[model samples]
Target: MIPIRDTAPCHSRPVVTWSLIVVCTVIFIVMQWLPYEVSYRLIHLYGMVPLRYSNPDWALAQGLPFDGYLSFLTNLFLHGNWLHLITNMWFLWIFADNVEDRMGRVRFLIFYILCGLFATYLQWYFDRTLEIPVVGASGALAGVLGAYFFLYPMARVILLPIPFIPFIFNVPAIAFLGIWVIIQLHNATTSVVFKGVSVDVAWWAHLGGFIAGILLYRYFIKPQAEE
Candidate 1:
């Protein structure tokens, strides 16, 4: 199920969220226009590789403070392809605004980065031996989805059944986000059994972000008085 939008009322404009989306899109567009070698180099330089980060020798040679320590932050902005970039950014657009409205600009930025950092570490911990580089903002976006689930559980979200199917169904935020989390859980579990080798994508990062988001929401957002 794909989320089109939510029913929660957004207060002030989500400057930080929109700006981040614009920045990511611009970076992706520039990379797309560049030659394959340049684009590939850019992703490698910015993306997070668990093995590269876990090795102190390589980190010393590359002048990095430590190996995987820094990749957690850099990896959030990296994407493998146009499709990856677009989908991640699209989700960011759909869900981030309301989250930012709830958290405010500065706090929201911190929340996003912190979630991304924690999520990346979780992914790395699951498979530190893998050399494949993990990239994309899905982990952070997953955090946004998690927050929305709690911040506005009663909000209506428009979901698309398929690419062409125009089924405009409104579901409660809890159910919507719950289904998303379940889907990710299903895929992550099945991947372990079906694929002998781990996939490059960081499914655990998505899970970690979700848990972090849920916890953060409970801590930061106070309960409103019932009408």
Candidate 2:
């Protein structure tokens, strides 16, 4: 389901959200202009590779530079392709503004980074032996969606379900995010059983970020003014 927009309104401009989008877009453009080999090397150097942490000796033996765990944050800004970047930024555009509005800029930024870090580590925990470098903002964006799931549960979301005749329908935020979480769990389970952590999609990262957002948002949420 593609989320077009939501009925929830924001009280202030989402500066942090816009800044994140612009930064990701510019980095992706630079990545596209780079040579294929350079781009590949860049992703490996910055993207989160579980084996880098799980087996430092192996990573060093393979000539992978020690990034000193910074990849946990850097990986959130890297994208594998245009589609991957666009889809993640689009979700952030739709949902992150409201989250930022509720939490304020500083707290929202901290929450986002923490969720992304949690997501990366959780993926590493299960796929420590895998050599693939995970890149993209989906896990962090999933955190935004999870925050929306709690902060605006009753807000109506417009979803376009394709494959069948294209049509739009409004559903509660809780239901939409609930379905998203279920799909992630199913895919994560399938990846573990069949692909054994060698899959392209970081389903566990998404699940971890979503769970982190749900669990941590309350602490970061701003207190409401007394009526």
Candidate 3:
């Protein structure tokens, strides 16, 4: 289901959330104008490639900086295409505000980066030999979705379950996020079954990020903080 928005309200401005959307958007626009070769190089250099880090000698042979660990954070700002960028930013727009409000801007930003890092590393563990570059904010955004599932379980979400039908369905946040988890789990298990096949999406990253968020959010959230 395509989540349009959530009924939960943010008591404070979601500065970190908005900043993330804008930065990712600007980076994506700049990437679109680069030459194909340059763009491919940038995607590989900046995106988290499991094989690149797993085998330092191979990475050096490929002219990649073997010691560079910055891709763990950089990959969150890079996306493959318009759909990828749009879907991730849209999910952030819908759900991140309340999370930011709960955790505060600085904490929210830290939480996001940590989740993304954790996710990338987890993906690396499962596909250490795969040469594909894993890019996009989906993993980090999955973290936010997981936090939202815990933070606002009863909150109402407006969804477009069927786009062409123009139907709007309102459901509990838990239900929507639960469906998301199921989808990720199913895809991750399927990916495990076909181990040799290279897949475009990082299903394991999604599951890892979601699990990390659920487990780590409480530590970030400050219940007694001022509004």
Candidate 4:
């Protein structure tokens, strides 16, 4: 399943959400100017790694400032490529306005950052010895989707069947998000059984953010009055 846009209307302009997307885009542009080795080193320094938690001092010595606490915030902004940055920012644009509309700007920003941090740790806990850097806004954006599910389960999502396919249709948020969660769970489960590790994507982070969004739904989103 894919999501094109949501049918719900926003009461106010989603300034923070848009601002975040712009900032990420600008940062991506700047990153592109840098040498690949430099960019890789920068991502490695700031991105989350499960091994960092085992010994804070060693992690800090490796350029993880403030004993790795800062990575939780910084990692969300880093992405591997144009596709990574674009897809994440695209989802944020599509789903975040309604969530921000429900929580208000300041609270929504806090909720988003916290969700990203918590999701990063959740991924780390599942694989404590991995050395690969966890970057991108996918996990954080998953939280946005999760929150959207709770606040607007009945809202319609216009989704394109595939990137190349012109066919599009609308589906309830719950069904779309439910399928998303199921796919991630399947990948996570299979990764554990076969590879004994998460190689590419941090599926555990998606699980973490999904659960966090579900748990915090009551506090984070307020439903609009019925028409």
Clash totals for all candidate models: 2, 0, 0, 0
- What C-alpha lDDT do the candidate models reach, one value each? 0.79, 0.90, 0.90, 0.82
Runs of candidate 4 with Cα error greater than 4 angstroms are 55-66, 222-227
User: 119-164 in candidate 1: lDDT tens per residue?
Assistant: 8888888767666678889888888888988878888888886778
- Give a tens-digit lDDT track for model 2, residues 1-227: 88899999999899999999999999999999999999998899899988988888999987786887999999999998888999999999999999999999999999999999999888888788879799898888888888899899999999898846678899999998899999999999888788634578999899999999999999988878710
Encode model 4's per-residue lDDT on 55-159: one tens digit a residue.
667667776554436777788888888888988998899999999988888878888887887888888887777777888887788888889888899999999
- TM-scores vs. true structure, each candidate: 0.87, 0.94, 0.96, 0.90
Highest-TM-score candidate: 3
Instruction: For candidate 2, list the clashing residue pairs, or say none.
Output: none
Regions more than 4 Å wrong, model 3? none
Model 4: lDDT of residue 224? 51
Candidate 2 positional error at 11, Å: 0.8
- The global Cα lDDT (0 to 1) of model 1 is 0.79
After TM-score superposition, the amount by which residue 16's alpha carbon in candidate 1 deviates from its true location, in angstroms, is: 0.8
* Residue 176 error, candidate 2, Å: 0.8
Model 3 C-alpha lDDT per residue in residues 1-227, reported as the tens digit of each score: 78888999889989999999999999999999989999999999999989898898988888788646899889989998999999999999999999999999889999998899888888888888878789989888989998999999999999898878898989999998998899999988888897766577999899989998998999999769455
The residue ranges of model 1 lying beyond 4 angstroms of the native Cα positions read 57-68, 192-200, 219-227
Alpha-carbon runs more than 4 Å astray in model 2: 163-166, 195-198, 225-227
lDDT of 2: 0.90
